[model samples]
Target chain A: MTEKAIEISNLKKTYSGGVEALKGISFDVEKGDFIALLGPNGAGKSTTIGIICSLVNKTSGEVRVFGHSIDKELEAAKRCIGLVPQEFNFSQFETCKQIVVTQAGYYGVPRVIANERAEIWLKKLSLWDKRDTPARMLSGGMKRRLMIARALMHEPKMLILDEPTAGVDIEIRRSMWEFLTELNEAGTTVVLTTHYLEEAEQLCRNITIINHGEIVENTSMKDLISRLDMETFVLDVDRVPDSLPDMKEVSFRKRDEATIEIDVPKEFALNQVFHKLSDKNINVLSMRNKSNRLEELFVRLTEKA
Target chain B: MFSKESLIALQSIFIKEVTRYFRIWVQTLLPPAITMSLYFVIFGQLIGSRVGQMGGVSYMEYITPGIIMMSVITNSYSNVVSSFFSAKFQRSIEEMLVSPVPTLYILLGYIFGGVSRGLLTGIIVTLVASQFVDLEVHHWGILFFVVILTSMLFATGGLVNAIFAKKFDDISIVPTFILTPLTYLGGVFYSIQLLPEFWQTVSLANPILYMVNAFRYGFLGFSDIDIVHALILLSVFILSLFSLAYYLLTKGIGIRS
Candidate 1:
């Protein structure tokens, strides 16, 4: 019975050209919940964020944040919601510190407090040394970090990040995810949209998958993963095998001369496969799960849709 | 908390925009100064010597105020049009739109930014004009009032343009076709008194004519038309345009798509 930070009841949006972006979507995000919105391109992910942020006018339905309706008490709702848009949307002429501080000001935070918060976020993002550089002069990764810092300036109760780490290097992406996870743990409700399923699997506890502007699935990550009956295991061998076990329940693919990818259902026993390998005198080099629970669930759900 | 907080947000946007234009003084401030100086040399000195006095004052003095007002109008209009349109193009406006900032505040922030540039350019052009003519300020209050109102009017117009503009070409169309013709015909080079009777009445319909005459009245305490009527007309234009701009902003016209 935790308090809901964001509640959308049958929210819908339709453009003037008769293109429906959201078709009666309803969901609730409880306080401190880390939810990931997974969807293919043009799956109404951006449209949903746009409506909640009040950047797009809703054709019908309602969105409320912290009990304030976005259409009625928009300022109050917006004050509590921080949106990190997918694209870089900052003035190139302004410095990183200026960008974050200005956004804080827009939310009515005092200049001193804004500057202090900007400093803290910049340091946390490892961008403190580049604070004075104009945003255009920063690398693509730095600009993305600056966008995150700017969104965090107001100390919002709920944060929505749209594709936060797309196009970033792997190391920076992992660090960003860590920072976001820490932020969520510190009591901010986070709703994220990302194309990277692995990142979503690692970070989110609640998951919602949208397809063609409709919420195809909305459930806990554990429940979603459990719904998928399939699992994959990668087995490493010392040498190439001339023939593989012809098991009907498992599918295998060669990964070079020393490895094979095996897909198995959850009901199947892995011990039988291992016994079969040992009987053939194929030494097992290593074995690892090819897909995490979330990945398996996502593949199953998206493919089914 | 609400009023004070909103005021602070408005002030922040205004300050940022002011800083943006001032940071590039060489490009924003200097060009108007140089352009006005050339107007003085060619129209006031070269053309005025042969033409003699206009409205019982030296041609240099008569043309000086109009030239200054012209710079103010163009600068104010261009500043808002180009800046806001560029923000739209870059999608940077999403930052403000997504924040808790009010729509009126966003509109005012951009309008004030343009007003600041227009007033600054007008002041610089006036100073440059002084080097060419012995200017006399008959009514400082009138000069200040007219310049401010004129700047606000054009700044609002610029915002309207920016709201409707979808691309770079949209920014140049009005300035080139409408603004240029209106300013040139609005008694910048010649007095409306010099025009034929039918043309005089036709020129009166141009809103820029009223602004130019009102500003001219401010400097010399004289005008071809009734100065009070001109002031009233300019006020009406400002109020109407402001209302229109505010409505467009609140409706999210051309901004929220």
Candidate 2:
């Protein structure tokens, strides 16, 4: 049997102003699984992570981290989890190396060992060169990566990152994704909350979507993506066409002389569209998804919730 | 919470707190040393020449211990209050809160930072006053006791202040309006014997007065309040403030939200 990395049952959180941030949501993550928690703004994603880290008190329910009860064995539970918050919470005056070393110290790593691990993590995250510089001096991307390095320093069993890639540029975001993928591959159970749906699709094997303070979907990524009923693709053609050709089981429209868009339902094979286009003697240069499948599903699910 | 790992966690926090204050020495360490030197110059030499004797001792000598106690109280209280409040404002305090470090350790770490500052300032001020007023050591044991206890007491109060404070103004309101007044009227420059009987009774209510008088008693072997009651009151305030600060910390009053 697979062990559960985190087991949250009937979790609820209601702020003092009577705002119900979470309403009895429950889910379980198998050990070593990479997961994404998707939600719209004010949909209680942060409140849920806050409760998991014990930053926000739960109104009701139970949370256990790696089988350690947060309420009863708080120290043990906290020891197994490291949190990378959505905002930059580290001190501006401290150097990058000091931040990570101090974090390791909080988890009871000896100073010598903590320093060694800090060096390793900072080097791995491409921050070793800037280790002596103050945190305030680092660029936005470096700061984001600094937070990740600090989280990884203690080697927690589960690393929870809340919008870790927010505001990062595309190139750096992809690099961070690679690093996190590598970290997850090293057997750390990773749970990420992100606004980027494509990142979720690329990195996560398990998917949990929360909307309106409730879990709308929790299943394997394969199952969730399979539930997507239709996908739209844009095909770039080599030659200009006077008019577009009609096709079966697909909706086609010319976006421009060189580009055409098509909606292909799950019932039709994409190869059939290519076969028909070839039969019409249209030279296709490239084809790409008009919209990311998970994105469309995310919008549809969150809009309904 | 009392395990070996907790001790290491405490040591880490303590080191950070110490490093922070020392790192900003101009802001943290130098100001108190400069302020106390100015006090010795203006109050001891310039004013004591005219004020004559107080509490059966020269005005300069009589005010020496009181001045030192004042520095300890003010510096200790301000140190913890400002440092902790800054951590809250920057949201860096969440580092310790989310860790396995116990709440008691968090409070102790900040208090020690305050205590260290208080004692250092007191020592520097005492040395500065020594050059102006003839130094005397009537009871070294009581001198050490009063100085240490007074620092601990105010450091705990500062922790409570920091825990409840929501904004920068919240942190200053207590020290400015309440702490300054209490310290001034606590007889740092004059003896309460000059006051009317009823005002003397009210002066007794200020906790700083007890600390100052006990410290005064240690220096000149003379004090308006009973030394025994002063010790008892100091212990009580320490216990109460420590308990309240610990409770506020565990409750996550202003820091959590």
For candidate 2, the per-residue lDDT at B8 reads: 77
- B1-257: candidate 1 lDDT, tens digit per residue: 34877777888888888888887888889999888888899988998899998889999999888899899999999999988887888888888898888888888888889999999999899889889988888888888998999999999999999999998999999999999999999987778989999999999999898888888888988877887888899999989999999999889898896
For every prediction, compared with the true complex, DockQ reads 0.80, 0.76
Candidate 1, pairs of clashing residues: none
Candidate 1, residue A152: how far the Cα is off, in Å:
1.0
* Candidate 2 residue pairs that clash: none
Off by over 4 Å in 1: none
Q: Per-model C-alpha lDDT, please?
A: 0.88, 0.88
- For each of the candidates, the C-alpha root-mean-square deviation to the true structure, in angstroms, is 1.4, 1.7
The CAPRI category of model 1 is high
Interface RMSD of each: 1.0, 0.9
Q: Write the per-residue lDDT of candidate 2 for residues B155-186, one digit (tens) a residue.
A: 89998888888888998899899999999999
**Candidate 2 TM-score versus the reference:** 0.96
Give the best candidate by TM-score.
1
